[model samples]
Target: MVAAADAQNYAQKLGIIHGLVVQELGWDEDTNDDLRAEIEETIGSELLDEDSDEVMDVVLLWWRDGDGDLVDALMEVTGQLSDEGFVWVLTPKTGNSGHVDPSEIAESAPPAGFTQTSAISLGEWAGSRLVQPKAPSKQR
Candidate 1:
């Protein structure tokens, strides 16, 4: 059994904290319930559903191979973020059913207006953090 302290550490690694609006997308039976619970606990509320129109501070997107066109999915979620928000793309780890190639995520993000910022192992799921590239400064 995973310790609660360890699980909380994992949630913290995703930058989740109290009062942030975290939206969840693509949840299925295969997604990690423990991790989801930890995130909800850290945020002090349940994750907002995909249909929520409120802008989000973080988007937790669960994806898999054969799910859909990742580019489109990323673009759609990007539109729902607050200016400084980001998305965490979680996919099944290697050897698991529905596992996605990391290269596929790397390629898909740029066209959707995001860049891969970091990646971390989340037990059965691997997480990639994506953020929109900062707009270039305007010269006076």
Candidate 2:
């Protein structure tokens, strides 16, 4: 019984984390709301099982096109978790360009322990936006 409960709890936690990712992708309002609710519920249910003195570590890696909004949302989410004795290790994603620097983001009052890491190339990130499937042709 205990094992089953643990499995269920882990699944719920995964769902919430996935929801946050979906929300970052700018999904529909209804879907976002539903996911947010599920995430909140899971967190509130003590699924994390952290003590009051525990510091939770969270890592966030934003895509190249991602802006401050992503960081903001991550901070908000981590803030909620911190209230329950969790600290976050946010790591914002940066471009692969040798000329591009990630320190700029870190200097802008990022969350404590937030690190910036080189992620997918900027060209790749931009190219993904352009590769959309075409719709079917209309019949005459």
Candidate 3:
């Protein structure tokens, strides 16, 4: 898996919006005791900072070129954080030419308002579709 800083940098190159760098310590394997301790300390500091508000949204983008286990690990972590806020998974479409499709993996635990997009470019795809919550019917 790519390091959090590297992943965030790549997302910036891709022009992703509101991309916050996150380090998943559980995903690391080769780190020694000292490195693990330091990582934990860093995570704690960031999470407990007085200026840091609770996370409201998260976007987990995994490539088909990467390991499947990493995707599974991400799902596990998201499950634990579900009540905190929305979580979206952007994964590659099967049999496509490395194109990503955002879908809800768990029906019982869908993201707040999951939907399909024509393309990853936010505005390029949004205008083609009209989305609104269903209105209640008139009573007899």
Candidate 4:
């Protein structure tokens, strides 16, 4: 297992590390596990458990759906973010099985009550940071 500092390093490069982070597993790979561990270290505790039912500040959405699954992904977790919270949808960069196009993300965002803010490049995936503008003040 990678050390906490390494995880934190990767997460920091990705601009993560804010309040309670909700990790929604759309990919469920070993790399995501490392990222999760790093994020937990960054925030100094275990992340919010999926069944916790609490508002989160940052959502690490690891998705591996190629074409048809983004809808389900967005629909299910869009409502889970606090008003000021943000969701980082990490998908395959391009060559991977579940690579999502940026245009596809733009088209799918608004209906889910999220705004696609920026694109991120990760070790093996691309990330789209989405935010719900109308959510209430966040806890962290």
Tens-digit per-residue lDDT, 1-140, candidate 2: 24464444422433234322211322222222433355555445332322233344322223232334444644544433332222222222244332223454444324532333322222212111101123377999
Native-to-model Cα distance after best TM-score fit, residue 4 in candidate 2, in Å: 35
State, as a TM-score between 0 and 1, how close model 1 is to the true structure.
Answer: 0.92
* Least accurate 10 contiguous residues by lDDT in model 1: 1-10
lDDT of each: 0.93, 0.32, 0.32, 0.70
| Best of the two (2, 4) by TM-score | 4
- Compose the digit string of candidate 1's lDDT tens values, residues 1-140: 35576444667889987899999999999999989998998888999997799999999999999999999999999778999999999999999999999999999999999999999999999999999988888999
Q: Which is the leading candidate under lDDT? A: 1
Clashing pairs in 1: none
What is the TM-score (0 to 1) of candidate 3?
Answer: 0.27
Model 4 lowest lDDT segment of ten: 23-32
Give the clash total for candidate 1. 0
For candidate 3, give the lDDT.
0.32
Worst 10 residues of 2 by lDDT: 123-132
